[model samples]
Target: MSWPGGYGRRVLAEVDSTNAEAARLADTLAGPEWICALRQTAARGRRGRPWANPPGNFAATLVFRPEGDARQVALRSFVAALALYDALASLTRAEAALSLKWPNDVLLSGGKVAGILLEYPAGPGGPLAIGVGVNLIAAPGAEAVEPGAVPPVSVLAETGVRLSPEGVLDALAEAYARHEGALVTYGFGPIREAWLARAARVGEVITARTGREERRGTFETVDDDGNLVLKTAEGRVRIAAADVFF
Candidate 1:
């Protein structure tokens, strides 16, 4: 698929973080551009978590401006997760093991294989930077991740298929174009349904932790606005942001 607005593509040997560079170029660039780096010295994930930037893995960010209400832009994370799922399924032999974890994670064989992070500029109406990192050739060890974090896996380890960073980026770009189009033309209803179909653990007992407060209940369905729905003994609760665990 073609990139939105025929935006320019830039590839760098190294950078502190592609998202940082994209944020800097957002205004000057005419349209959304794809920024890819061979290595990131200070890469980060959701909530400022340090992301491993091994040379063989994929580290890329797309900088673009949203047309309408910016608050709804947060739903792009689900769109991105769907794109990543499509890209990985095209290469993996264990297709059945692939599933999308809520919020912003892609799982392979029940282990984390890829992650997405969306960042915006200082003020409103600025470009949105979508950062994606895939464990292509090497997965991080227990020591590299946070304490009690889910174990990570790489595409190579899971499917015995080796792919270059550029190769994965090509597939991702194509998949993103298709899913992004679906979000625009059909609206969030279609995207939400597609996401729920591949949901990692639906209709199961789980816990969602947001800061100090923790809520435990049966995982219901995500709402129209993308908030997670949790059915508790007391009543139904909607979580705008939280870390979920099974």
Candidate 2:
């Protein structure tokens, strides 16, 4: 269940459902870098929708039991996004164009390249897990996406980057270490700066989706509380958890 060195415990070589397995382990087995990976897992996006986690694609969960509050735990999504951005940067020349959509979706040239899902226990002071899925190769079909939802893309085999899922995992963990230090010191501000530096153009009209509600508006910047600011025709709005499309 454990790998040598700082590498996480590899639960199985499943073709489906890494998140489910990791979620089960979060209560008992997960420590720092307690990982569960799947060669192929079902894609469930932010709003209870299916994602495409095909073979050769990246589907894994990185569990962290930080001694912090919900605020810090929620900030893990941003930290994970930064880690992924750094990993992809090492693999491609189009690194400058990478951006973090609100919440924790990673975007490359306007299409979704990766997503981060944060899962935690209901009560206080419990462990938490983050599920990250990147399109290393092949995207979901139109049937898997909502009618108006934005299309998606992959990194490997498309960005001229030949990366195995393990390679991505390694690079991401290293990147997370660097940002985690900053998180411990200066809080999410410093990490958010790094995220915005790679983000797509803000203040542009786009669609934002939470599980319950959806809206179209101009994208504002992320506030200090990590909430996304949207300038809708209705007014300026803040979304606590939602998938952003720009």
Candidate 3:
């Protein structure tokens, strides 16, 4: 399958974090590149939450130089999530239960089966890394997750079809290529529509927490800039970064 920017690919037996490794290789790599790890000793999710993947799970990162403002580039997380949704929907019999959660998560049967994380350098117009972790064969139990984090699920559990990590990676790479191309050609409008169609909850009540502040509101649609639009009794709020809960 064709990768974004025709970048190189590497699969490793182990790594600290695919995002970190991608950053280290950004300067040397010409364009977009992918790094997949069989296992991660120091995996992490959004907000530095420790992420531990079992042997059969998938951990991969894509490093690329985007051609736009840093804020625009950050929206690639949504694209990545959509790509995963597409891959999972095409591969699983339980497609009806699959949905994309706001910001950066894919839900299967109301449980999180995959997540996307985006990272960039200190300044703008530099190389950015997109990290994706899929619970293909196994998912951590409740004891392994954070106190209030969403419960996890695996594709195998949801579909009764076991998929190898490499198989998932190949499908992900192809799906991402399609969505990334769409984003470049059409813009965020099309991507937004596609995402909203598969969104977990819209027009539902939800809570968003960031730092020490919390806001409860009706979950509205995402704005053009990819901010989560929330309608609270006080007023309309745009959430750029927060942990959303239903």
Candidate 4:
């Protein structure tokens, strides 16, 4: 797919994972806003989990070598979520209700529509890579998604959205540049406004996983550090990581 900006996309018929492939090329690739789109991907999703990437579905990775700090990494995910949201919204009025789940996940009327995975290389001078997967033609089995959570949704011929994987990829890159520019120039103050406009909700009960025990609380706000602030029974809390839900 072609984008008007100085952006470019490299197509892959199939790959083990776009994020992994991008990581392999990080040192050699010189392009700043490089994107890799895969027709099929194996073992996708954040935290190295598996996501069903059936043929003809959307699977892609966008690698960015930002002139920003790790503290500003949340902007990457926010821009990604907004891009997907705007694309889907433009394609279908049914998707007008799309919202963003904190950190990174796209929700269509409260059900998951897309998921984003951000990878930051270890050590200094490492850039961030974001992997995004959307159920274009098919949703995953219940066993594959978060348990006891909202059912999944998709955008494809089935949803009457008539969107193609290539179209989504194009939209992602274009939308990303716009939002990322806003973030870099204006800081998170404005990005947070755009995010909150489509955010899941405040005061909604959620559980955050931290690799240890789970913390349950009401969603508060996005703190200055980009961490999610959850208001528990004790007090407001900051969460660096979590599998959130309402």
Cα lDDT of model 3 by residue, 1-246, tens digit: 444458577999989989889878888987688799999989889888887688888999988887778677988988998889988887776779999888899999988999888887434567889999999888889888656667999889888988876777777888888888889999989999999999987999888889989999998899999999999999999999888887
Q: Over 4 Å off in model 1, which ranges? A: 1-5
lDDT for model 2 comes to 0.73
Which stretches in model 4 have alpha-carbon errors above 4 Å?
1-4, 121-124
Query: Candidate 1 on 118-225: residue-level lDDT in tens?
Result: 998545677899999999889999687655456899989888899887777777888887888889888999999999999987999888888889999988999999
Error of 2 at 134 (Å): 0.9
lDDT of 1: 0.86
The Cα RMSD in angstroms, rounded to one decimal, for candidate 4 relative to the true structure is 2.1
TM-scores, all candidates, are 0.95, 0.87, 0.94, 0.91
Error of 3 at 4 (Å): 6.6
Candidate closer to the true structure by lDDT (higher is better), 3 or 4? 3
Weakest ten-residue segment in model 2 by summed lDDT: 1-10
lDDT of each: 0.86, 0.73, 0.86, 0.76
Q: Which stretches of candidate 3 lie over 4 Å from their true place?
A: 1-5, 121-124
